[model samples]
Target: MPFLLNLLLATAAQAPADYTEPDHWLCYPGREDICTEDLSATVIEADGETSVVDFPTARDPEVDCFYVYPTVSGDPSPMSDLEADETEEGVTRTQFAPFRTVCRTFAPVYRQVSIQGLRQLFAGSNKGINPAMAYGDVAAAFAYYLENENDGRPFVLVGHSQGTNILTSLIAREIDGKPVQERMLSAMLIGFNVAVDESGDRGSFKNLAPCKDERETGCVISYVSFKSDAPPPQDARFGRPAEEGTEVLCTNPGDLGGSGPAALDAILPAAAYGTSGRPPAPWVKGQEIKTPFVKVPGLISGSCMKEDGASFLLISVDADPDDPRTDDIGGEVQVAGTILRSWGLHLHDVGLAQGDLIGLVESQAAAYRAKD
Candidate 1:
C-alpha cells in the first residue's frame, strides 16, 4: 500500500495544468531574464474599411508584409507568445488572426502568423528538446503560412535565424519548383542558407540578388554578412554565390527600374527599426578587421556580386553561424542534422547604405499596387 501510494502521488504531481497562471507561477528561477519583454511590437488590423497610410507618398492603403521570427527558447513550448488571447470558450493563438493587422501595411489583405510554437512541433511534445524535429516544425509553419495567409495573394515572407530555415523550406517546397510563382512578391530568408542541401549552390533560383527591374516578377533578397574570408558554401547560408549556372539578377537598389539612389533613398528610411551600429558587445578576442575583402579564418562572406550596375554592398560581421552552444533545445537532434557537427563560424551581413529595408517593404508593395 505504501508503494502504491507513492506512485499515485507521483502521478498527481505530473498532472497537466488546466490553466496557465503566470502571476503566481514561477516560470524561471528568480533573477533570470525571460527575454520576452524585449520584443518591440505593435498590433493593427485593417479590414479594407480603415484608412491606412499609402506607400511612396508614404500613405498607401493597400500594403501587406509578414514577419516571422525564429525559436528563442533553447527548447520548444506551446506557441503562447505569438497569439495569446482569451475567449469565454478558451485561450487560443487564433492561428490566422494576425492577418488583419498584417494586411494593413502591404495589401488590402495582409496576414502574419507566428509559427514560434512550431519549435515544439519540431522538438516533440517534450517542449522541443529535439533539434531536427524543431527544424521540421519550422518548415511546417512556413507551409501553413503560405497555404492559409491572404488566400494566395502576392505577399512577402521574412525570417531570421531558425526562421530563415523555415523560409528556405517554403521557397523550395512552394515557390522554387512549384506553380505558386505568380503569387509571390518576394522572400527575405536572412541569417540562414537557402540551398538544396549543404553541398548545393548558394541559392535555389536563378536571380541571386534582390530583383529591382521593372519587369521582374518575384525575387529573393538574401545575404549573410562576414568581416572576413567566407566559409565553405555548404557551411553558411547567405554570402555565397548562386549556383554556377545561375546569375544574380539585380535591379540596383540605387537605381530601381528607371530611378536612381535619390528616389530609392526617399523611400527607404520610414520602415527603419533598430540601430545599424554593431552590437554593444565586442567580438571575441582577435575577431576585429583592419581591411576590406580579407577573409576571416573559417568565416565565409562571398556573395553574387554584380559587375554591371551599382552592385549591392554586403557588410559582414564575424560570428558562429549555427552555434551549437546556443542550441539549448534539441541538442541531440541538431547533431543528427549535421547542423551541430559543423563549425559554427558564419558571416553576418546586412545591406548597408542602400535603403531602409522597412521602407523597401513599402516600396515593393507600392510596385505591385495596380497588379492586385
Candidate 2:
C-alpha cells in the first residue's frame, strides 16, 4: 500500500473493521441483504398506459459486480462511519440493487466524504475532507474482494461520482495491464469525467480501452449525463475535456459504440426524482405508483455529443405533447433554492440508463464465459 493509504487506515476511527465481516458489506452472496430485495417496476408507456414488470428469476451467473457507491453519506463528520444509513441504503436500491439481475452484487460500505464535507469543499474550505480516507477504504475493500470472493470469476467494477474517482485511481494502481485486468469484464465509471489522451483515448490507463460494443470485454463504459437543452456551462466541473488537449470520455449506455440517438431503457425510482423527496408526480392523470420502481418506455433517449471542449451524454426527454405521460424527469442537484446546472443530472448517471446497463452487463458476462 502507498504510505498515505497505510497511514489513513492506521489512523481511522471505526470506519472499517474487517472485510470478512458481514456488516461492512451492503450486498454479499447468500446474504439476505439490500441486493436481494424485490425489484418490481411499474412500466409506463408513451401513451399513458401502465403495467408491472417484475424481475426475472434469480440465477447463478459466471460473473460478479463489485460496486462502490457515490457520496450519499449523511454523517455529520468529515468522513462517514461504516454503518449504512437510510440515504446510503436508498441509493443502493436505486443504483446497485438492479445489477443483481446479471451478476452477484458486492457493495462495500466505506468511509466516504459526507454531505457536510461536500458542502465545506464547495464553500472553499476542505477542512475535514480527506480524500485519502475514502480512497483507503475503497482500495482496501477491493483488495479483500479480489483475494477472498472473486475466486477467478470475471467481475465488473461499477462506481459513480466519488466512487468513480477512487476507482480510477485503484484501476491505475492495481488492475491496469495487470493479470487482474483479465478478470475484469468491464467498468461502468459514471457520474464523473474520465479523460482520454491523444494516444488513442488511453490517457486514463495504458491497456484498457473504452467499450465499442457489448461484445467487447476488459473495456470501460463511462459518461456524465446532461439534459439536451441544458448542456454543462463553461464553468461546470464535469463534461469538460482535459486541460492538456485530452478528450473527456462519453459512452452512451443505450448505444455503446453506435452514435445516433438511442432509446434509454430507464428504470428510475418511483418515489421522487428530485432532492425534495416528495411522492412521484402523476404518471398519467390519477394512476398511483404502487411499485418502488418505474419504467418509462421511450420516455428518455441519450446520445453522445461534443461541443466546445465538452463531451457528455446528451439526455433528451422524448415526451409527446399529445401523449398523456409526463414530459420530464427530475435529476438536477439543488443547493439553497438554486439548481446546480453545472452538476447536470449527476444524481441519475446510472438511473438514466440502468436497464440498458444491466442488459449490457449480461451480454458481456456471456462473452466472458465464452472466452473462458
- Report how far residue 16 has shifted in candidate 2, in Å: 5.7
Q: What is the TM-score of each predicted model, taking all chains together?
A: 0.42, 0.93
Model 2, range 169-199, lDDT digits (tens) per residue? Answer: 7898899989999999899999888778744
Location of the lowest summed lDDT over 10 successive residues in candidate 2? 1-10
**Which 10 consecutive residues of model 1 have the lowest summed lDDT?**
88-97
Q: Write candidate 1's Cα lDDT for 113-144 as tens digits.
A: 12344333434433422333333433444444
Total clashes in model 2, counting residue pairs 3 or more apart in sequence or in different chains? 0
| Model 2 TM-score (2 dp) | 0.93
